[model samples]
Target: MCETNHNHNIKLDKNGNCNTDEHKTWNRRSFLQALGLVGGGSMMLANTPLSVSRPSPLSIALSQSTNENILVLVRLQGGNDGFNTIIPVYDYDVYANARPLIRIPPSEFINLSDDYAMPKPMNKLESVWGEGQMKVVHGVGYENSSLSHFKGSDIYANTNLQEDDRTGFMGRYFGEIYPDYFFNPPPSPPSLQIGSIGNLIFKGPESDYSFAVSDPRRLLQIIENETFYNLDGVDENCTYGEKLRFLREATNTTFDYAEVISAAYERSPEYTDSSYQDDSLGRQFRIISRLIRGGLGTKVYLVTLGGFDTHNNQIQRHQQLLTSFSEAVSTFYKDLAADQSEDWAGRVLTMTMSEFGRRFRENGSLGTDHGTAAPTMFFGPALNGSGFVGEHPDLNNLTRGGNVTNTVDFRQVYATVMKDWLCVDEGLVGRSLLDTDGGPFESLDLGFNCSGTTSNIPSDGESLSHIPTYSDSQTFINIVTPQTTHIDVSLYNIVGQKVATLANEMLMEGVNMVINVKDSANTRLSTGPYVYQIKTNNGDYSKSIIIS
Candidate 1:
């Protein structure tokens, strides 16, 4: 287990002492000197072939090993239909036949040769896939749930279908592993929620760990201004006043750190184009690239691209939105490779998710209604690589509205990421955030035996009854199942709310489906213990992802 250093401080000096006036002066001069040094001609020269290898002097010294574990979550809000983004060229004949209006012809796909290909707009990712660094997770979803944008999104975001899970899965891990020092909280002018008010993936109770900075370059400046310093204004004691004060201070520190990061990005010779649609999603990815290259100490980052609520106009909108996502993500990947930060190279992992997938059958509008069981993708360094995880539900065994049944529990993916990729000990993960033993994994073939050995198979429902022998925070259900899928599973945290609707819409039998959930980035769901429930065709089942 990684030892927690509760005394860690962000103070300027290594001696664990206060900065001297002379030292402060030195830093100020250093900051101004660095600013003055940026010459236009020098920038052009740096951009030339001569400056390719020399990274910015401002880049922070980071341990390549730990840094490589960075997690980049790209939330495709409004239910991104994975079918269109990652078209099955080998099966395109079937997919195109399913939704002629929305299908990307086999001719248009960038083939991987093994029956699958990326949509044309995602040509950039295709190139990355060839490099043996990318992995694709198909047909990911939980059992017994269909496309209901609101509930589906919440499920994925919360991981535990509990309504009272105040802290998110990632947030809980961060809090337990890197407990915040109250003295040095986040500086904030509070960045805008570009796609929305942040996803549940980043929320926690300790220090404010994540910031949805719409434009870090601009927002950083506002946070650092002296007026906002310490954030306390004249009306310091008032509730609103105190709130403003906190935001000011957080904003200041964030920008100060961002300045150093921005400089590194500016120095890099590799430049990612602002091409690809020029939309908010495109811009967000562009900025993420900037921050990463800039050497920001950000470990968990969030970005989203919406418009997948394809209740209508599924063809045009879904296509365009996905193109933007693919293009931007691909470009970001290419730029990272060119930076030659191999340590940082594979360190970044990007995953895509949505509320819930549309129905397996098409609606009369030449579109699809809110159905469950859609495909999701997890392509990044930490993934097992190539191929998929989890099982693809049989489309024939769907619910009333033709929602494909699911086989995988979305929390398994989160558990894998929290324990396997990020290296957080299961104990530190906090059961309050993820109660894996419960929910969809209980019935799936994930291979989890709870017998000490880590297996990928889901456990028997009875096994979920045991309060884990280990810490609730870090224990993960070891399910043994294929990683790829046709219909996907996702998890969400529902605060203390009990299972209100456990009734299955009464569908065809055989295979059971799972739930898909998503949530806000900041703030706790609600203060109380919670339960995660998975509603499937057979019945509704739930366990605790988190018990807080």
Candidate 2:
């Protein structure tokens, strides 16, 4: 098991310095940075280049069914301090008592409701709220939330509490919708991910669905130059050489979308919104607005704003982060509203998500520690009205560790958005979220519905279940099939080189088939981690397995 350290649980002295031995551990960001993946341009996952001549049936169907509504997921990279962001004016005494130094004065905050107010740094949202373009879902989080940044992020992205689960909910949805995604990707990039390096949000079973760039500047360079790596000289004879060649080819194919992105950017009007600061978050929103206005057709876009882990000197740091977020978001809508022909502002929905919230009580430092539950803010005219969705977590009822119990499950929020905003089918949304374990999660009404238009994608209703297990000597794959289906199974190395074809035959109905890797491969396999992909008429599923 990986070592877990809670940032808020660290012992600090009166000087606001750690007094205990800090466990120097690797989080997802640092690990990706060490691998030279973070801030090193775009990440190319295992996806085939989209064919220009012929669009797939699934692609055409998605194009026709989708009403051009887009979802922008803004990630507050570190855990945001919910108490500070959404001040509980009704319980101001308890809130002030917890953080007297960092608490926002009543005069400094703008009142949103009789009970709740927002800090002055986020004053820009006040106008948005008055226009009925904003809504707050109070105390949104899961039970037993992981306070560790890496794990918490994974839980949010994958919607799975299991530590070993790697696939994300969006990835699973894309996998189901485009079962033949490896051979035929959609016309445009399915999603565009900017920043938030090493996040699994768009990770499908066999590949990642997003065209992920390190930053807005790198994306602009790709758009301007139509850049791609040349794979002419790569030797493909040896195993390592073959993997390198494959990766390079994949990287080049990823740049294929650059042409469309560039075309869209070139056709769109320049951002003249002076309210948008020339900061990281502002730049991201600016680019996203251009793509949407220019008809890129991408459905989802994820952008990041870091430095939310306000462990010390909370007042100034939190203020700056929230200020950037508020200004960029507010200005983005105005930029979209400028395009009166499209009503682009109504078609776009922006939502904020952080891994978790800060503790109810303040630590020795002027900041709060990692806690549970925070207010999730939804912005855009599509919401129809501005209001709170759920009750705020009670300050009097805190966990033994000084964390508030989440009043609303974050998955419920995801399910609702997927069903309503994106027009995804309710059943498919449940499956995509892996909500089968506890039965389907109930959706919350956030003032909008799908308008009777649903996705054309078909759901794989318990047709197959692919499970992989390992013994001391060999690996075994247990597959359950409800009906006879042609199944193809293959294994690939970590770098995405095809290692072996395990099976290429039909699976009988109502039969539990367990295939031994050693016998199926008919060769000695390397003793390390490998991914096994199961392809069937139902869908494609993949999981990581260790060979001994």
| lDDT leader | 2
RMSD of each: 17.9, 13.1
The sequence of per-residue lDDT tens digits that candidate 1 reaches over residues 41-147 is 11111111100001111111110113235667777777766666666565455566667776777677687666667777777677567665566555677766635
TM-score computed on alpha carbons, candidate 2: 0.71
Cα lDDT of model 2 by residue, 406-523, tens digit: 9999999999998888988777788888885765777787888888675554444665777778776678999988889999998765445577999999999988889898788876
Q: List TM-scores for all candidates, in order.
A: 0.59, 0.71
Candidate 1 clash figure, as a count? 102
Question: Model 1: residues >4 Å from true position, as ranges?
Answer: 1-67, 88-101, 113-115, 181-183, 186-195, 206-270, 274-277, 381-385, 430-432, 436-548
Error of 1 at 420 (Å): 2.0
lDDT of the candidates, in the order given: 0.48, 0.74
Residue 59 error, candidate 1, Å = 22
